[model samples]
Target: MGGMNKIDEPTIERARRGDHRAFAAIYHAFAALVFSVALRISRVWHDAEEITQEVFVNLFRKFSQFGFQSSLKTWLYRIAVNTAINARRSHLREDARRLVYEKTAILREAGPDPAARLQAEEEANALLDLLPQEQRVCIVLRTIEGLSYQEIAEVLEININTVRSRLKRGRETLLAWKQGEPK
Candidate 1:
């Protein structure tokens, strides 16, 4: 059963041809991780779920081109990141824009009292708002998701040095934001 933990690239290759079960298994294996990527990128559970569904739909649609150039997890995350960004952008539409804004506001206000612990989580999310999407994604992938620089580079399709630059710049930006704030 040890082999169960690993996806068979050959099986994936067959699935690429027309195997529905293989695709279903692949989806089951990666959905949570993809959802986590969506959540981290989006900073909201509902948006993440929506993004996760969209990612899977897109993945299945684009399955024939997966190419096996990267691990399935890496590819899945790349898809998740791309789809989440696109969906987040699309959420600005009349159908999604008002709902997104309203939901974000509700989450921000639905917390309990201004206790220090609660405030800390809220503050961190607030700080992330100050980051550009690329930097935020780099920090989240490196620090939060514990992906290697190479993995992040593959997922983001940027050079390794660019990942380093983004992580550094992201940390500095967060530090500056923190430092510039009232105590």
Candidate 2:
């Protein structure tokens, strides 16, 4: 949200009016943030990349619908979160279908010499995956994205107390997981 504040009303107006430069400027400013959020939620690099592209396409198409009521960052966060969640759900469904047809398909492990950091990150993401989707989203926004509880509430359109509760539960679950306790 730091660099995001630099995008002013005039820039937004220009983008809304279909100015390509303005739109590109906005994309440049926010694409990384959006992609990181998507990646955290989707847990697949390719899916996250696609989600980022889809988000920008949707923003361009729906730019005119954005009222000035909410900050643009909040609006973008809402879009990114919803889009990522939907993509993750669709991916899970597709995987289930594929599994039914490819029962004999062999699974590949990570490369023989994967980086330690990468392995740790994969383990962390796997743990996050164990949480319910709602709780996972709350934890991602709060911890990884450094969003405030109120900001998370605004982005997810939930009560602030619900945000707090979800984060609390999510943390407890992750702690239990790390401690080798049954979920």
Candidate 1 residue-wise lDDT, 1-183, digit = tens: 113236778778877886889888888877768876787677766888889888888777888888877887788888888887876676645353233222344346555653554556566667766788899888878876788998899999999999999988888888876789532
lDDT of 1: 0.75
What are the TM-scores, per candidate, against the unseen true structure?
A: 0.77, 0.86
lDDT (C-alpha, whole model) for all candidates:
0.75, 0.83
lDDT string, candidate 2, 1-183, tens digits: 455447878999999999999999999988988987898888777788899999999999999999877888889989999999999899888784322111111123345444554566667677787799999999888888888888899999999999999988888988998899957
Instruction: Flag clash pairs in model 2.
Output: none
The per-residue C-alpha lDDT of model 1 at residue 36 equals: 67
**Which candidate wins on TM-score?**
2
Worst 10 residues of 1 by lDDT: 94-103
lDDT of 1 at 80: 87
Compare the candidates by lDDT and give the number of the best one.
2
Clashing pairs in 1: none
